[model samples]
Target: MLTAHTAEGELVILTRSQSLESLRERRKQESFYCPQCKEQLILKVGDLVIPHFAHYQQSSCRNSFSEGESPAHLLGKSQLYEFFSHHTPAVKLEPFLPDIQQRPDLLVVWGDTEVPVEFQCSTISTSLVRQRNAGYYLLNMLPVWIILTPQSIQTSTADILTLRLSSFLQFFIRQIPNRMSVLLTYHPQSERFYYLSPIIHLQGSTYAARHLTLSLHKQTVPFSLPSSPSQTDIRELALHYQSARRKYLRTVIAYNQKGIHNQFLRACYEMRIQPVQLPAWIGVPVQGQEAFRQSDCEWQLLFVAAVRETRKSPDQLNTSFFHTFIKQFDGEPDDLLAACRSYGDFLREERIDIYRMDRFTDGDFVYEVLSGRFLAMYAKN
Candidate 1:
């Protein structure tokens, strides 16, 4: 808590220029209170910690601030407050909004919008994320979350920009309208921002992304998304996607269970095909791959097997059947349907017969689907 109210109901902000001796003297004369809870506060002008107001240990205020706030969180919040203050006159440090019963680290007015900037330096749950966003949306205020950079970020290859997104971190990902999805993070120590933009989910947690770093000094009030990847960059990413798909095939052969109880393996067995020996077209990367938590190969193989069991020809392939088939597997309905439809459309367009699986064994065809056709589909003209 950085702001407080004096006995005279005057607001006192610690960030403003005020002598410590004068504050200590004032502490002796009058009592300061919390702006949100209206409870009495203790002003701590310590040598180690930053000068700020803290509530009493036994205070029953529901709007209690600074209980679990770490030193990093405090430092980042203060730095962001100063940074946003420079850009707009309507910047506030930890403003408690009674309407939502939420206190954002910083709130800045951008044009006619009130943006709540959350400097999250700790782990958060998905429900909590949804709740906070819902609260902000309820008030017609857009919320921006800048997470503290993790200690390590794993990359798939040194040549291309890639990231392994854990389920927890995936909660931070946001998709702007008519733009790509991105995750924004900040390092308070370096005072730099790491923007993971145009994230393409290869399979499961593996994603092909572009990382952009920007110093706080160069940042603006409304942050900007990085430019789209160039042709060469997208080509490299496509190669990475190909590598991941190859690795998935290898992993399925080596690590996954092959028993009759194993769903994907059972389907492969019934189709008289080895899991690794499946056609390259079955597991090729497509848009909306993020909907599945498992490797796209698993569900995609099952889908092809189901189609083969029906003995459907190119013209006889029913999209409604494909949608219902994908619905049995867990995922976002629209996205799952889109991915299945893309694969089904490719089969029909190529006039490939699902029953006669022996016709399409071109391993290089996967690259064509990913690099040529898939990339062209997403490419901005």
Candidate 2:
């Protein structure tokens, strides 16, 4: 086998153990050979299939067959399995399902017809014939057949440990794509292949050494199901529904404010905030404060509100303060101010005092924030 280097992108080839050992011995151009024929081999920087070899054209000597391995071949089996499992329909292509028992080299079921695939490149045997002929009678499945005619390897490199039949003989006979391709983003660094477009009847390969990747220009199957919570299941959820009547009641609800609630929670994340039930929920605060185990509820609420800078503090509000915080259009610089003003306006109507801060020009912003506080407090029982 020959090897060509200086190629772009990433590639790894498994050479012989002695080849590496000899390079350390002389560290110079040397002779490697076919393990079978002992003929001289070639090695040069080449294309995608690197360190390639060619016959000398004078002798019939060449690489025969043996156990070998290749990075591409390994990647092929993996990608092929995943692709088939995901796309091959269990219903439409029921007959072709792989048989775990009496496993043939390769099985193909086109409708009820079965065929056994085999390779007859350098060697042929009666075992292959008997296997293919008696495939389904013994295994009850189709016999899909395949063969390989490998080229003879002649090399001059003396330390040719890289020559193994395992290197090139990949066992990837999978169902072809019947749909379109899903154009996925291929990131070689991470060995990731992300599909964006749906490619039909796709044929591709994947290599996962340090990274996961699928060979591009392959089929994409549209094989997925959307799973959503059913309406009945949603109605049965106890998180917000109180009763059967509430579940059945039809109402026009616009927008869930969970994200807003989450934002407020995010702002107060570091303040050691706790959830508190409203006085109404506890049957007038005196009825259920013990289960919560805390006093100074109003003070904590007020302090936490100011600290989060949510402008929800029930301190005081004036129309000018509202103007400072409110923006006419969405996402203006003063939109945060508007948010603050909106909270203040809501509070003023609820009996907070009236004061506005425009420009402090002297003190910290928190001082401006906490200057006015709600005098009334909610004490935990």
Candidate 3:
């Protein structure tokens, strides 16, 4: 189902099950936005569309604007495109063909055949890699694979070497083909690209962000230990940061509540920190009267369904029934409050069981939960 990782609610879309009425209710219930790309995404409640995310913009982003209008890659693929455009023939970037399954990043019409320039950064599923290559081949397009690296990885000591570690390691691991057209490595600072080998070694993929981090550190940290980021790591980082920001913004804009969501996003953007996953709300179901181990009033309000008010409802909310129940609980309603308290206490105690169960990797963000916790999603105005 199209749901948040925390499982509170999901925007599931499947054409076979839900009717129009149910779909309408969900629209009224909640809204969703893309976690990555910071775009508004639609989540259909009914079964008309499968429970999957679709980008709002249909066009393929030849560049994700990571460099953000940095004038394309210098010794990068765009440089290669510019060179080809000048020398060869009609150079069309992101070409579409009848036989080709999807659009390619670049295509050059050379003689009777079309040469496809596929420049990929970061890593994707191995299956997707093969599909892209095979698709170009099927359309009778000569595939020129260009795997570009960040602009900071090149070093003076490694310059004279016949083969560098990043290229060589991928070769040793059987990642790239020996007969590739071009293998270009660029440095953002110098805006220079080094032609490593005529026979390119297509090694595994690395995350652009992490690679940038390692490269920047190489000034002191020494990057390129023959490494690539796993697809899961890259994808989650991409998804969560985008999702978290939007969720935080929505919470802030709608409620203008100063503390939790606002502070969270401000910290991330200001520090440029990326959260691994967006805040998720776990499901909580109350046990029946007989199900309680001890139902007596000895513990009383400690475990009572009706508890003391948290924030005195701001005038209007105080009188509203909806706000009445909400104000009563310091954290979440139903089973969620105890979950947050227990989870918060567990985090402060530095327990591993919480990490494994909650799947929180970043200790900083998770620990922040101990402070206020998004104890409650938000009460509607």
Candidate 4:
């Protein structure tokens, strides 16, 4: 912990410029204690790591809230607290909330409003992230989670950095124009904030992202969170989607020699539908549909088949049919809704007569793929 209570009940914080000799001398004069537990703490002044206070190895306070704080975590938290304190005097470090039974790294009070600021340095589970956010919301406090960038980020591609997504990382995804939502992180070493925008998931545990950096010290204007992707970013994502689709098609064809597995591809071949030659509107990327385990091409093939069936009998396009179709693939209702919206956009772009259901209810939707001539034209196009 950065700050600990002394034998005189005075809070003492070790600074970076403090000499080891001086720290050792101070430790000899006064006993330190854990601020959270009031248990005895040992002043650790080391050559490699930062100077801080820690509980004794056998102490039960080792499991307390202030325990296990890494040097980088402590430094970052202290820096953030200092930054906020410069702007307002209402900032408190490691404030415990009795109602929520939780202690945030920093709590800033503005009139009746309280904001909980969390400096997250490690991976956190999705459920825990949601629980924390919910708890803060229940207390009428806006919870802001700031991520500490990994050292690997220094050598990563400037525009297209890769990051592992946790539930906490996913929660901060802000939607921007033309591209999908993105995650944000802060590099304490550089005192810079990074915006990992428009992330494209590539297979498992990998993503291609475009990022932007801003210096926290030189900022004259208030930071505005991006809400949309630029045209250029959208174009790049479209090209990437095309490349991924081609790769998926190649994999499917290579493994379909026995014709036992990949029934979807086999059906496509039997129906004289070349996977690579599908309509442009088929493989369009939809925002927030990354949770679907199926590849883009697979979902696109399903859409093509649905359109074909709808063209054969327009009455087949209804809520029940849509639900049944989506059930064939593993995705949430939100994913299905996003796909529906993407399909609607495709129809409008291609000038097709397929009408999307304007009103969507819990158990009902109305998607009509009318105009067989338009479907024929789309097929040929």
Judged by lDDT, which candidate is best?
1
Candidate 1 vs 3: which has more TM-score? 1
Give model 3's TM-score versus the native structure.
0.30
Best by TM-score: 1
TM for every model, in the order presented, reads 0.84, 0.18, 0.30, 0.78
lDDT of 1 by residue, 70-131 (tens): 76777678778888888887888888888889999988987888899998888888788889
Q: Per-residue lDDT for 37 in model 2?
A: 47
Q: Which residue runs does candidate 4 get wrong by more than 4 Å?
A: 14-22, 110-112, 161-168, 176-180, 202-206, 219-232, 258-260, 312-316, 352-381
lDDT of 2 at 223: 23
True-structure lDDT of candidate 3 = 0.36
Query: Per-residue lDDT for 33 in model 2?
Result: 48
Which prediction has more favorable TM-score, 3 or 4? 4
C-alpha displacement of 65 in model 2, angstroms? 14
In the order shown, what is each candidate's alpha-carbon RMSD? 3.6, 25.8, 25.8, 7.9
lDDT of 3 at 40: 46
lDDT of 2 by residue, 1-381 (tens): 222122232122223232544443432454454333445545433334323333355545522221232333323322333444454442111122234323332233334454443323333454645554574656564443323323212221221111123212223222223211222222222233332211111001211001012342343433231122233322222112122112211110111122333322332344433232111111111111112111212222333345235444445444554443333323334533443443444334333321222122122221111111111131223
